[model samples]
Target: MRIHLDTGRSGEKLAAEWLSQRGYTILACNWKYGRKEIDIIASLDNILHFIEVKTRRGHGFGMPEEQVTRKKLKNIKTAAEAYLETFPQWRRVQFDIVSIIYAPGGHNIQLLEDIS
Candidate 1:
């Protein structure tokens, strides 16, 4: 059987729905600003959340959260700043990473929040 890696997109979709179920208003997904892309942008109670979604099949390689490097964090921060500039009314903001581990059988997916 052939297994294709569409982890990034799948993770983002899962994260968005997860947030929505918790009452977050999703403002954007896969938002691109120049060369940077934010996986999910959401707000709840006037607090903005900039999210990064990481997905892996298992720990055979490494944990999904381990993929976010310092440079990647820096880029996400810069992108958040740019996003904030466009919506200064946001009272608070936070950065979060959603780690998803999906099994090969398409079941037993687990989500870890704020891994960063």
Candidate 2:
């Protein structure tokens, strides 16, 4: 469990850095609303993004993004609504997933946007 958590944290860090390099301004990390959590919240080109970060060592289970089920997306949406209630400046909102495959030598990352 600890290893799994560590890998998730590492992946989220990488995802944040990757998004920053691509002109996203990170607003929050691990932001929670009620019982739900948003792994990362960022803005780019005037659009607010709620991102879910999923990481895995390999494809033993499946691709990282494949783990984001409809229920997970619904949770993210619920959290995002709470976020907007606090800060309603964003007119355009998007849901995304940052999928990471953490290997020994290299890591594969992919961004799936507008998931919701």
Candidate 3:
């Protein structure tokens, strides 16, 4: 449990920096609506990106990207809708997944964009 928590935090930080490097402006991290959470919210090219970051130490269970199931997407979409109600100035909203896998050597990160 501790390992998972640590990896989640680390992955989020890394993802935020990666987004900045890509010229994305991060608006929020860990944005929540009710019981659900959107890992990151960023914008670039007039598109508001709702990102979900999944981090794992290995593929023993599965790849991180595989963790974003239909239920998760539904929750994220709901959360995004709720967010827009408060901040209604968004355009071209998109969904993305940042999958991080950390290993003995280093780490691997993949950004799968516009999954929604």
Candidate 4:
């Protein structure tokens, strides 16, 4: 469990940095509403993004993005709604996923935008 948590945290950090390099301004990390959590909240080009970060050591089971099921998306949506209630200034919103596959030598990252 600790290893899983560590990997997830590392992945989120990488994702945040990657987004920053691409001109995304990060607003929050590990933002939660109830039991649901949005891994990262960022804005780019006037669009607010609620992002999910999925990290894995390898693809033994499958790609990291494949783990994001419909139920998970629903939960993210619910959390995003709660977030918007607090910060209603964001009229344009998008859902995204940052998938990371970490290895000893390197890591592969992919960003899936507008997932919702």
Candidate 5:
């Protein structure tokens, strides 16, 4: 349980850096609404992004993005709605997923935008 938590935290950190390099300024990380959490929230081109970061040590189970289920998406959407209420300045919003595959040599990251 602890290992998974650690990996998730690490993946979120990596995702923040990756987004920063690509012109996204991270606003909040691990931000929550009720019981849901947004891994990374960023802004670019006047659009606010709510990101979910999934990490995996191997592909034996599946790709990181594959783990984002319908229920998870629903929760994320609800969380985004709540977040939007607090940050009304950001009228344009996007839902994104950052999948990280952490392996021996290095890590592979994939960003899927506008999932919502």
Candidate 6:
């Protein structure tokens, strides 16, 4: 099934809002490098966080977090390195994942943080 981009963007927005409420300050959204994209770059205190957001309409395929394979992690790491170069002041760097499972028949959003 092909996922619609508008729906995906809405999910990302919801995930960002949830993170912001948890004290995370968002630095970038949809930051890309070549073919890879980092959904959210955020900071909490002094730690710079490279975050990936995955969304699913249902659990038929798998949990959203399960989609982040090792290869995908590698891409995120590479893209993050490029991202950090822009902010040399940040010494602490970390990676995180936020899974958003939208309600099967509605707009409800559920979030899981730091899965990676």
Maximum-TM-score candidate: 2
Minimum summed lDDT over a 10-residue window in model 3 is located at 83-92
Error of 3 at 28 (Å): 0.4
Q: What is the TM-score of each candidate against the true structure?
A: 0.85, 0.97, 0.95, 0.96, 0.96, 0.85
Across 25-49, the per-residue lDDT of candidate 4 in tens digits comes to 9999999898999999999999999
Which segments of candidate 5 are over 4 A away from where they belong? none
Once model 3 is optimally superposed onto the true structure by TM-score, how far is the C-alpha of residue 103 displaced, in angstroms?
1.6
lDDT per residue for candidate 3 within 48-115, as digits (tens), equals 99999999998898999999999999999999999999999986899999999999999998999889
Instruction: For candidate 2, write residues 1-116 as lDDT tens digits.
Output: 99998999999999999999999999999999988999999999999999999999988988999899999999999999999999988899999999999788999989998887
Q: Per-residue lDDT for 9 in model 3? A: 99
List residue ranges in candidate 6 displaced over 4 A: 104-116
Comparing 2 with 3 on TM-score, the higher-scoring candidate is: 2
Tens-place lDDT digits, model 6, residues 56-79 = 777777887888899999999899
Against the correct fold, how does model 2 do in TM-score? 0.97
**Model 6 TM-score on a 0 to 1 scale:** 0.85
lDDT tens string, model 5, 1-116? 99999999999999999999999999999899988988888999999999999999989889999989999999988998999898888879999999999999999999998987
TM-score of 3: 0.95
lDDT of 5: 0.92
Cα-based lDDT for every prediction: 0.80, 0.94, 0.94, 0.95, 0.92, 0.81
